[model samples]
Target: MGVASKLKDGFLSAFCLFLIGGAGFVVNVGQLLALVILPFDRHLFRSISTWLGSGFMIAGPFLLEDWGGCKFSAYGEQAPPDSKVLIVVNHGTDMDWAGGLSYLARLGEPFPGGAKAIAKDTLMYIPIFGWLTYFLEFMYVKRDWESDKKTLTKQANQLGTSRLPFYLCLFPEGTRKTPKKHAQSQEFCKKNGYPVLNNLLYPRFKAFTLIAMTMRDQIDGVIDATFAFEGEHPNMSKSLSRKLSCRCNLICQYHPMNELPEGEEELEEWLRNTWVKKDALLDEVLKDQEAFCSKQRKYEWKQEPLDYTKFFALVGVFCFFLVGLSVLMIVNKIIRRGVLVISVITWVAVVAALVINIRPSKVGEKKPDPETSSRRKKAD
Candidate 1:
């Protein structure tokens, strides 16, 4: 890329990030106002919050697919619309889950409650994205059983009772793939007698098992999704510059939760066994990319023309909201103060959510492996 083009790309990416972050902050303040005036119902609040989050989530996918000209081809039967589901996906890049928004958008109407992710606890500290999503109520886990159990169980109980349709997305690998993590994962799996994966990390399955057990009867099924990118994986810079011609191939499989094994040990085994299959499935995807294009096509890669009409509509609404907020703030100084107050409140709430410890779990948490249990107990 030329120096001039690189500078242009940097400027555009910065502008987009600034615009989205500022606008999201304004919208979240509005969300706080709505919550204050509206009657409280957990299900109703969650559904509305998820819907709002989904709107912001579209920004990532739109930038990648519409602006950057990335292509996506997906396989497997679509999950039933308006049914609760748990999505178990392999994480390849930071942007992998961002691709999910585009894939789900193309699948038809979204779930009533849209999506809530199981995010690592540290993400809550990120500036604008973190503040905005706090209102959207994404579940955050510390990855420590002692700390995570109370939070997960409380959150799961709420989810289990909700009649609203939603997607609970989990990256069981806990982190994105890297050479060091992959090597450590192989070591962990080999020593523990679990299956070792080459192109993926061994899943941290204890949390998955707990949540699945907690919400077994409530959710419909689980979706195992694997994403493969054919060329350079586009980050924000590559995406803004349109410097890479990227095609992401996604494969999914649906497993009904009720059909899963009952015991914690059995369920953990089931999850491991499932990952073994996913590892081989990824092997197939990588092999296909390296081999003859016309090899027996197990998954017919469909390159449908991506219609930008809906995305444009979403952008229009976003612009309108920002404009309306500008007009309101200009007209009334009190409203401007209210915005600052909302920002302060957001910070306080974030701190509380981070430091406040929930009571010990009444929910039956699976005992950690003997070696790890001692460390967790000490941490507690």
Candidate 2:
């Protein structure tokens, strides 16, 4: 084709993508609105989450590094619908959080209702999604024993009664992954006689002890999520935000909710052994799926698909938000000192999404279609 035609085609494609992304945003906002009015409605959130998830699934291919091959597999994928879960994972990079969430959504699971995270107190104020995550029932820790104990107690009581499923994702390494951090964790495990694995930082058992005691009756199962990036990036930091044009791997092992060991001594031993086993399991899974880990899974669903007409209903809402964000950006430039406004908009978007996603915490509130559970099973 001639230069003019080529330019025209490029513009058209860009324009079409913009419109598609814009439409997705509007549907998401409406999904959020619908959730807010029915904040305690578990059924509503599941349906809305599916739509929003599809939006992300569609956009992810464009924005995330390899949108196609992200893999999620689980150990004990099945648990009682209403059971409370304690999720332990290796925290390595910024993409860890988003990658985990994306895998869960694809599995057709909304994160536990009122799920808590053992996170730095400052995460609540993070520029984009951090602010939104703040309102969820999180246990903010000061990285000290005494303070964490008190905070965990208070949040546990609150979460137990919220009637929503609760989960606390902990990073045993206490920070992002690095060669130094990984090496140190390995040393700690070796001194304790634990196996070495390429999966995550050395697992810390202290927090696990507290979690067992704090939510004893309420906690039903434990999940160990092992994350690994595709390709030969030295570490996660180097690969993050760079185009991942292929799928990533998230290997999850679901340990069925078991009784907390009887004695303090036994519990401690259990924690030590669990961490060692988890590391080994991850090594095997990663090795087997090295290539397919970055490839997409094929699953068939026989449900009613989205109504595009209904999806388009909220186009105006998305446009309004986009314009507002754009105007705020322009104002920031004019004020010269208002660069923080961009951060503010991002914060609002992230928080609003979480709020829209809230659901009942109690058991038997509503059971999502078993299909979602099955989809999640594959991802786990």
Candidate 3:
């Protein structure tokens, strides 16, 4: 991409992120109000918040397509609305999760109980967007098994008892794929006598196992989804570049939970074996993109037009809140001044916190070796 084009794409992409984050901030405030008003009705509060949050998330796919010129195709049987699902996908690009979730949102119907994911704890610290995940009730883990186990266990228990259905997305690769990480993974596989994957990292089976065992009764099936780009490998930067021309494809295979092994040890073995098949499948698809595309069911984008109704509804809600706040300020000078002072202080505090906690990590920090890092608790 030319420098000028790249800058335009970057600007558009950043604006989209800011728009989504701002929308999420409104939704999150509504969720907090719901929690206070419906304290006794946990299910009602959860459902209200999740669906509201999803309205904001719906913009993700559209923005990606518009800014990046990316096209997506998915081949798989759609899961039933009432059925709970676990989506186990390869994490190739930073946009992979957003793309998949956006596809779900565009599926003509609402996602079951609104889709949630097991994401890295660091994501929870991100400003408005991160706080939105909390409203959606996404499970965030520290990537350490000991700490994550407790969190997942508690979450699973809650899910087991709840009547709402969910599609819990998990990235078994544990991190985004990089050439350096791929090389490290190959070496680790060689030492461990496991198959080396060219396009993916070795699957981390522990988190998958814990989730399956805990929610076995509730989960209907597991969806094995593989995402591939048509041209060069597209990381976050490349995907955001205006010159990006790669069409993305997602192939999903569903396996019933009952068909999986029941015992934990047996299940672990089964998962390893499944990853081997996934490796081979990805190899075939990547090797001959044309042949693979010709054989699979093509996803028709026409069937899933962006839902403008929901988009406008969200905007209307936000406007209503803004107007109400303005009216309150006009009627009460003391309250308005107090609110302005508090808002200023809050913004300063947030900026200071980000500078202290987040900025340093982005500079002069050495990343852990991929080979050994897999065994440590960390987020993808």
User: Which candidate tops TM-score?
Assistant: 3
lDDT of 2 by residue, 155-192 (tens): 77665655555456777666776666677667766787
Worst 10 residues of 3 by lDDT: 356-365
Taking all chains together, each candidate's TM-score versus the true structure is 0.78, 0.60, 0.82
**Model 2 misplaced stretches (Cα beyond 4 Å):** 1-76, 107-115, 190-199, 228-242, 245-247, 285-318, 322-380
- What lDDT, from 0 to 1, does candidate 2 have? 0.54
**Tens digits of lDDT, candidate 3, 41-145:** 888887787677667777666555655567767776666666678898887776776577666775544452277888877777756666777767788888678
Candidate 1 — what's its lDDT? 0.70
Q: Model 2 Cα displacement at 292 (Å)?
A: 9.8
TM-score of structure candidate 3: 0.82
Residue 194 displacement (Å), model 2 = 5.2
> Which residue pairs collide, candidate 1?
none
All candidates' lDDT scores? Answer: 0.70, 0.54, 0.72
Identify the candidate with maximal lDDT. 3
Candidate 3 residue runs with Cα over 4 Å from true position: 1-11, 232-243, 298-302, 319-380
List residue ranges in candidate 1 displaced over 4 A: 37-39, 111-113, 290-380
